[model samples]
Target chain A: MNIGILLKEGPYNHQASDTAYKFAEAAIKKGHTIDAVFFYNDGVNNSTGNMEPPQDDRHIGNRWVGLCQKNNVKMMVCIAAAKRRGINDDVLIDCGEITGLGNLTDIAIRNDRLVTFGD
Target chain B: MEEFDDDEIVKKIMHVMRNAPHGTIYTYEGLEMILIMAAYDQDISVAFVDDGVYALKKGQDTAGIEVKGFAKTFLALDGYDVEKLYVDQVSLEERGLTEDDLVVDVEVISSAEIGKMMTEQDVVIQH
Candidate 1:
């Protein structure tokens, strides 16, 4: 199965980003191909390289970068939403690429499933 | 950016508005997404439920709230070829509103009906 994920909430403040990561990891383990993870709303915050959690805590942004790198999945943040929240290329993680909503529509069309994780 | 191909499959995408227009940016950003998606020539529909019903109510003046009012933007959706707009009947009555209270035309339907429609959609994005 080729699945696309739409994540719409920020990390730490909401459990949405965490659950989305777990779901993607489990899906990959089950032999499914993750087509892409498109972040909108505060979900773009998950692409920030500036985040520094406690050594004992999970680093949400790094987790996404690592997962996408290991599995060869595309990580996209909506350009319009990103700009509204001050997320630009300078602060974006390596795995995250700023894109447009048309890509989201394309993701919906090409993927077998388009799942949303948000408030 | 990749150009949208006319040969690509047209998706049935529904944007579900579940929040009030103000006090948060969800509804506003959701609208921005819809406007962009509409240009792709996909089949798009919008459902206003919960406090989202208030977004379509007539005479929204944001001057006092200090936020730019986007209520009129809903009216311009038709120009983008996005004409399928649904309003929750129960939500309207609960808020002491009717179809007449809305600034734009929308089909007033029951939540169950909307649920059935949602199942038919390829992508249902809720805000």
Candidate 2:
């Protein structure tokens, strides 16, 4: 199964990012392929590289970056949304890419499952 | 165009509406998404839960709010082959609304049923 995830909230304020990450982890563990994780709305914040959580706390952004590195899953943040939120390419996580809504449309069309987590 | 069949390549896509109609674009854009996906020739259905039931209220006059009234736009969905509409029974009752108060026709179902149906779908997009 190929799964596409849509995350609509940022990292700390909501559980959306955590849930999406866990869901993707479980899916990959089950031998399913994750086509992409498309971030929209405030979700674009997940791609920012400037986040600095407490030293012992779980690093949400790094977790996503590692997921992309290990599983080869695409982490895409909406370019327009990112720009509006002041998340430019210079601040994007290393493994993530800033894309457009057209990529989201393609993700919807190609994936076997498209699940969304939001507020 | 792609082909879809109930027993074959049919994709069960459910658009879950969890936001209100006004104050934000989630509901409006979600409707647009459903309308677009409806034309894709796939098996499509809509579920209304949380504040989403408010989107179907009978007398929504957004004229005062300056936002274009899209409540009536939902009524036109049936013509585009997007007629499968379901609302969460708990959500409706919690909001002090009944089936008769809605502008369009919808099957008032339980959240359990909607949850089970969601697990079975090939795609579940929540807005």
Candidate 3:
């Protein structure tokens, strides 16, 4: 199975992020394939690289990054949302480079299920 | 050119609505089955909108119910190559939410644009 996990919200705001990751992990465990992890809208924060959860808490961003790395999943962040939130692979700020809808189109063309997590 | 199934050619966009407590889940679940079948057999697209967006919410706590992980099953859609996920901008705003509130990166479009997208598609399934 090939899966596309779309993350729109941040780590703490909703269960979408965790839910998507859980799906991804379970799919891989079950020998499924993950096509891409597209991060659009607030979902871009998944790759902000500046998220800091307490030491005892789960570092969702890191976990996601690690999961993608382990599974060789294509992790895509919405350029627009990333820029709006100042999220980048290396840091987070008030403003940064933006992602475009075209990127989403590209992913849509290749993957099977474009699962979204938002509220 | 190769022939296509008329029923399969129609692009069906399934909007997953898990927020509503009652009959909504069944509605969305039915839509999910349809989308999965369409995408698995043909080409179909789905968008998760509004509070319905959380239907794909991660870390789903379905402890009380015996329902299989609907969100988890979503990750398997790629096997069918159905990969279009869109969210409504107005819905998010109306709920005092921004992209940051969702779990995945989804295409955020306005109501007008959503309507337009719907028209272009062969089918639109909202739960």
Candidate 4:
């Protein structure tokens, strides 16, 4: 199955991003192809390159980057939502790219399932 | 935006609003996303459940609260060709609201019917 994920909350403050990451990892392990992970609302915070978490805690942003890299999945952040929360190309993680909602529409159309993880 | 190919599939995308307006940015930003996707010519629908039904309540005034009220935006959705709107009947009655109190005309149906409809959708986005 080809699945797309929509994450709508930030890291640490909410479990949304963590759940989305874990879901993606599990999906890939189950032999399903992850189409993309599209970030909207506070979800864009998951793509920030400036996050510096403690040594013991999970690094949410880097986790997403690593997952996308290992699995060849696209990570997208809504440009409108990203700008509203101060997320831009300069601050974006290497695996994530800022895009318009049209990409989300395409993801919905192209994937077998478009799952949302949010508040 | 580029035109969709004739052979392209038109997915049924439903945006479920479960939060009240103004208390959070979910409903407002969700509306913004709906407007953008509307132009893509997909099969789109909006469902108002729980506190989401309050987003369409008539006579909303955000003047004193300083937040720009977008209750009227629901009415403008028709202009974008997003005409399929559903309101949960139980949610409406629970909140002491009726179809007459909403800013737009929506199909007031039971949550079960909406749940069945949701199962048929290719994508369901809730805010």
Per-candidate clash tally: 0, 0, 37, 0
User: Candidate 2 docking category?
Assistant: acceptable
Q: Rank the candidates by lDDT, best first.
A: 4, 1, 2, 3
Instruction: For candidate 1, write residues A1-119 as lDDT tens digits.
Output: 99999999999999999999999999999999999999999999999999999999999999899988999989999998899889999999998899999899889878888999997
TM-score of chain B of 2: 0.92
Which stretches of candidate 1 lie above 4 Å from their native place? B1-6
Candidate 1 vs candidate 2, lDDT winner: 1
lDDT of 3 by residue, B5-97 (tens): 653232344444435322334433434444435433444556656566665555676657765456656556555566666777777777677
Cα lDDT for residue B48, model 3? 58
lDDT of 2 at B89: 99
DockQ of each: 0.76, 0.27, 0.02, 0.87
Native-referenced DockQ of model 4:
0.87
TM-score of 4: 0.96
In model 2, the runs with Cα more than 4 Å from the true position are A26-30, A54-56, A79-91, A98-112, B1-9, B22-26, B62-69, B76-80, B89-100, B105-120
Could you tell me the lDDT of residue B25 within candidate 2? 72
| Model 2 clashing residue pairs (backbone) | none
Give the clashing pairs for model 4.
Answer: none
Q: Kindly report which residue pairs in candidate 1 clash with one another.
A: none
lDDT of 2 by residue, A1-119 (tens): 99899998889999999999999999999999998999977888899998999998889999898899999999998776778789988898988888776677667767777788996
Candidate 1 lDDT, tens digit per residue, B25-118?
Answer: 8899999989999998888999999999999989988999899999999999999999999999999999999999999999999999999999
Tell me the tens digit of each residue's lDDT in model 2 across B1-127: 2345543355677888888899877888677667666765678899999999999999888889888889898999999988899999999999999999999999999999999998887778888
Q: Among these predicted structures, which one has the highest DockQ? A: 4
